[model samples]
Target: MTERHHILSDNAAALSDDAYDSDGFLIEEDGDDTSRPRLYDGDQLEREERAALRRVAGLSTELEDVTEVEYRQLRLERVVLASVWSEGTLEDAENSLRELAALAETAGALVLEGVVQRRQKPDTATYLGKGKAEELRDIVIAEGADTVICDTELAPSQRRALEDVVKVKVIDRTALILDIFAQHAKSREGKAQVELAQLQYLLPRLRGWGESMSRQAGGQAAGGQGMGSRGPGETKIELDRRRINSRIAKLRRDISGMKTHRETKRGSRRANAIPSVAIAGYTNAGKSSLLNRLTGAGVLVQNQLFATLDPTVRRSETPEGREFTLADTVGFVRQLPHQLVEAFRSTLEEVADSDLLLHVVDGSHPDPEGQISAVRAVLADVDAADVKEVIVVNKADIADPEVLDRIRRHEKHSIAVSARTGEGIEELRQLIAEELPQPDIDVDVLVPYDRGDLVSRLHEEGEVLASEHVGNGTRVTAKVNADLAAELAAYRA
Candidate 1:
């Protein structure tokens, strides 16, 4: 306990029987050049991480009887991942373990070890069985870990009781996910959403900042402040919660204003009677790449999750020379946080107002069908499932033929294409032109040449079956959508 206390902070050194550096600074690592290929080991670190470990070996207390895991997990807060396989089979347990590993990685936590208990249902007080929870605490102590990452969201009371017993930080799946988002989000809107989720998570986790609250920041409180109070107006954790909430509100307002801007733009397109097509899919499914292929949009192409948060709208002409708006939306993810779905609702509403949905899938992914299911879940959450969709089996170049065949066989509205190689793009464009709603009738008339605006509008916004020119007037024939057909009623061309 004295060693554990020192490892955490200064005031608690007498609990465990080991020595520590008491140095406050963390050894820095280079984050530049994000293009390096990641080498993940289930156990043991890569050479670089091993070198770093050697450097810090003498700086921190060493524990005996620890096993190394395969992953470039270094300088990570050690954590125990616990899960209850309720209604979960062996496969489910393995999958839960894998996902927990990913979550722990994402949260900058090293997986010291993992444990799964089977139960018909979760225990009310201790997510795992009461005895098992005690065993887990012992595991944490043996591994010298100070945190536990649970596989499910724990109720408030359950969280408190478990932390009290475990005497370690315990964060659930949702909270861990939120923390990763907090770390990954770069854009203003993304930050706002992440902070909102974090604050909401903290609001419940704030019962007490756990044992750390008992220690003062630098030394004893100079005045009459309580142990948790430190020397500030509010404790560090409380101030963090308050700051997050304030930032969340500010972000909500900003997102609202941005939403209005989107509405205004939508209204402009609506008034002009120009139809829109929105591209959406699971993260890393090549939505951005498809947008670039379809419209030469020049959207950033990255091989990472949640890379593009800002919506990019570009114009493209169909094979029939008909122009329409193509919009690229943020990618969806498995178990996407509700706060994000809510925060980006306006951006996603672009899908709701679309003329059609280009639902792209990475036919190459091992679980393309599972990705589809995850995406559909999010779409249903936002009430956009009924939108007309064209299934685009993207990444055909690297995808297995069997995988492509499986999707084609299982889904009705599917097309296989390599967005990078331009394979099947022309057919896709022509198909898009055909799937678009047609005008009720083709209007034929001659108009004054001075109304070039009307002539161009007819050409761009409507399908022109024919067009000719006469003295001081232009003769034209075209088919237009219902809305544009109405707006062009006076033009009659």
Candidate 2:
């Protein structure tokens, strides 16, 4: 058997059972049953509902005898993480496995154990070598683990080979992430995009065995099967693939339509010259918390990865009363599935089109720099690399001072802030105001009293330097966009 090892502390292996109720809502544990009912908004209620339905442990129904062409659901329970250290240091491999553990937990699985193999490269036939694979099987059996999650994306053949040896279901990082997205996606577009990515990932990996997968249909071969089974037909796998393809096509169309609606809203914002700032970073890096801190958006804030899959856009104002929209986007991760990037291209475009990006980083993480690199890689994939960035080192209240100093020193336009404790938030706000796009055209306009809407627009869409009321109308001097400048041309003073 593989040597017994604790990938994480015992506390990290399982979440505190008392922290949440059976419905997944946080309940004060003062041992009082007579407390008032906690009030939750719609979003919070939906999130709690999703959490309540999370997969239970030891409930996975995957058959042990089925090795080939098994249809696996992400009903992960009692999982063992496996990784091969090819290039990075041993610490890096451990960190990767730890992250995998967090991911499994986020997907509602209990992490039993983890193992890392020091290989120059992953084995071709099996992810781990033959001996190591057997050892892993032994570990799984000993720990009663039903799933083995590889740290890297596994090819179909490799996954099959690994499962055959391990005698249990095996999945990769990509599928695990996809499953989390599947569970957390709430919006229609978000759900559709996630389904599209899942189908894309599943198409190439579809496999089958035995005559049941065969298309052959005749009197003897059918074994007294009815007339419907007598004709030359496509295999079961083929039918499933075709259905998935059809669903994918329809999802694409639906997502396309939704994309157009999103673009129209964006176009309206552009027309109004409202600046947009997208909060983006690695998963669980406090992007949503920061959004709430800045805008009181009250988005779902959980200590789990990929908790916020649907992008939330909220209108916010800078300290100077200049209005801009802040978008909380889907968090990026290392090796973010390309299928997801393609599927969520429309949503990611919000980042690409933003006036600025608040790249939040977890200052407490051991490998913050690595997380930054991974996020940037995905940003490049979405063509958002060129957008202006303000590195916001979050969790400063609990972060290592040396790590915070290192990050601030390395990033030119970085600020350290704590979303939880409200530390350095004012400085972050000021930094954002400075980094956002500024209106260039200076306008001095005298508007009629009947055109008060113009005055409000001036205050909402541009920086009003000065304003005064005259007998004829209200006179204002401000900097505005070209579009708004044209609207004020007739009233120029």
Candidate 3:
């Protein structure tokens, strides 16, 4: 079934006093009130609070099972969202929840209902307070929600406690995001990295079957059939742990190999003096759309979050025909899962290694500024902080004029453009051309007729404006990078 989310009005009220059952499981408020758990009204919260909650209640998208080595899609889960509004205004909290709703949608869940409670800090045990959790449970029950998605990452104990109370599966922001990555990963290396990250996350969360699972029951008496399996008969959980560890190692090895290949390609580009630019931003900020706009890359462009996982690099040139490469990389998000960061490090290096970064932001988003900060936070993690940036405020056709003004006021070098309509593309291109690193030297040189290779090298490694077939050789006038300028020094005219 197609995925859909329900955004409640901002004025909806919270659950009334009589909404709970004797056992405290949520059930529908209007249904027969038996001793059994009541179904949550699914709209217990006030219109405003409910509006703050972008509950993805109806649609179900397939999810990948992280526990398995092979990629497998699990049944879509029905999820309810819960968030704590400790800091920021109600609008801010609502926006955060809205993003969460999008994430849940991306993970293939029908968001049922969302709730938020005002708290200074999350409870150390339940994330939500005990009372709030019960209320959440009530809502989950009422809606028949199979899963509860928290706005923040939950500690293992916290997660366990929440599950015990809600009687449903619980996942935090990190896991939801990692699941999305696993779903979108397409390439061999991308899959390997995602799996490694999943295992790393799963290793610590693995539940053993008590002390019996920890004890070694080796030898023929224990039904050990293999030569090496005699001394250490592993329990089911132990075997799973071992297998995951082994897979992690192999994945690292595979990723390292892929990294070496990437480096080789980067080296070749460097040798040719091709300038590289990388596009990065918050998830679903239109990075792929922008890349397609600039290069006609025809990459996948979807309305969903994290629609593109693998990096795409295509050769593109400026209006002056200065050749450079444009790479579209995985988008960042607020509190990006650390495991993903480490696993995708090699891929993100494309951004760090670029001569310029086209930081795209959805000017039309409710909080474009927040998106900027989140993307920068991840970029800092990847050590791309020092890379020159040109903030591209995309979606101008639909963006709020006030928001665009706010962006332009604070970001002096920012440009507003609509990637969909091609508006302001020329100005964006010109800005990119101007921001890109320029050649170190411009000179007129005449190469000997016999050494045509040098003339060709000049074209490859420099920006040649004019070349002529002179009596002795080809006369070339061009702007050359420092490396090539040195090589052309002897031929300078």
Candidate 4:
């Protein structure tokens, strides 16, 4: 059982100098929890922390002795999930479980079984009432599941309580989602964002890694430290907390620099007078395939959800010869972790700034409409609701006819296509070309035959409504963006 997400999310107590909130309102950590011991309030900290932290902060840590460990990758854990619904209907609870299953699958975990408990209120200390938690433990034991994933984000105490009772490692929805993100991240930028998010989430949970050792109230050095010793040497949990905070600060600054660079690049695109179309949809919806199909971009396309987490921008010419930029960004999901959205805020701006949006849907999904709702929910959250959108029902070749009809009936601006077979691709392309804003100016111009490359460019980058031949020169009437018009100004005769 969990608190209403909308109401609980705004609490400042939900955030810290180190960790931040992801979807499901769970805290994700990035670094050790016991670095700084100076920032705790009231009972969260113990005495004799500052002296411990100051001493440890002066200690030097070494990395030169590090050795690479080759790993036969750990076998992915197959999991069973449990959820308790307090205030919502059965439908809400089921939908939440389905999403959790998806998150588990995304993290490469096979969902062996699932259970949902209903109650008017959740037990404050244990989440599910005692009887239900015990029952869930039996289910996990029967299924021989490798792990237990909870639908709700669990507090440190709650996580421990449940794990102790369940007799297995327990991770809530937020951590499971983070694990998926950690695996899907592929770009330099993508990796950094995921690492920063993971570290931030890992901070607070550092309080007691199953050891009764009181975290040094000193912050980062909460474990223990001599006058200048790092590690768990006499530092309190507060010391670990401060170290994470400092690392978070550096990551924020780095991400900010990346944001500025993106802004500069965006400015350049605007100056070039090119329209932009950003492809957005739920994960695994064929966005990458569509981009490669439309523009020959050759982006690494994988079948997994969130496979295309980093944004890829490519230049493409519409059939009418107009050039525009098409960007592929991370997919939206039901309850997409807010921390990811916040951390990737600059990237989502790629969607917000685009001239048009292509909302791709996997027509084959069992709940296409639900997927649509999930995507729109995140879009609204990211401030992209006002952007013009065209729904593209992709993977139609394998979709159920009844579902397809239902989708088409409800979608006024939707089209169906299979990116793989090239089915309906031409119609989709024409629809895209016609949907863009029409340029206002139409002019006739003449250019010497030797400037044929310019002439070719005109054909590739404009709507050539008419043309005439005149003694080694071509006179043409075309509709084009203003920048191109200016470039052709001298050729007008």
Q: Quick one: best lDDT, which candidate? A: 2
Q: Is candidate 2 or candidate 3 better by lDDT?
A: 2
| Deviation (Å) of 329 in candidate 3 | 0.2
lDDT of 3 at 129: 70
Error of 3 at 217 (Å): 3.7
C-alpha-based local distance difference test score of model 4: 0.74
The models' CA-based lDDT, in order, is 0.71, 0.84, 0.83, 0.74
Largest TM-score belongs to which candidate? 2
Question: 2 or 4, which is superior by TM-score?
Answer: 2
TM-score of 3: 0.81
Deviation (Å) of 63 in candidate 4:
42
lDDT of 1 by residue, 1-493 (tens): 1222111112211112222233522222235833333334434323332211000011122334255432333466887777776553445454655566666765567666666655556779977656667877887898889898777888888887788789999888777767766676776766766666666666756655564543335335444454665443456577666776787788778878877888999999878777788899987799999999888778889775656777889988788777789999888766677767786788789898898889999888757887788888888877788888889999999999999998999998889999989998988998888877666667776778777887888787777878888785888888766665665577654
Q: What is the C-alpha RMSD of each candidate to the true structure, in Å?
A: 15.3, 15.7, 9.4, 15.9
Q: Sort every candidate by TM-score, greatest first.
A: 2, 3, 4, 1
As a whole number from 0 to 100, the lDDT of residue 403 in candidate 3 is 94
Report how far off residue 338 is in candidate 2 (Å): 1.0
Per-residue error for 413 in candidate 4, Å, reads 1.0
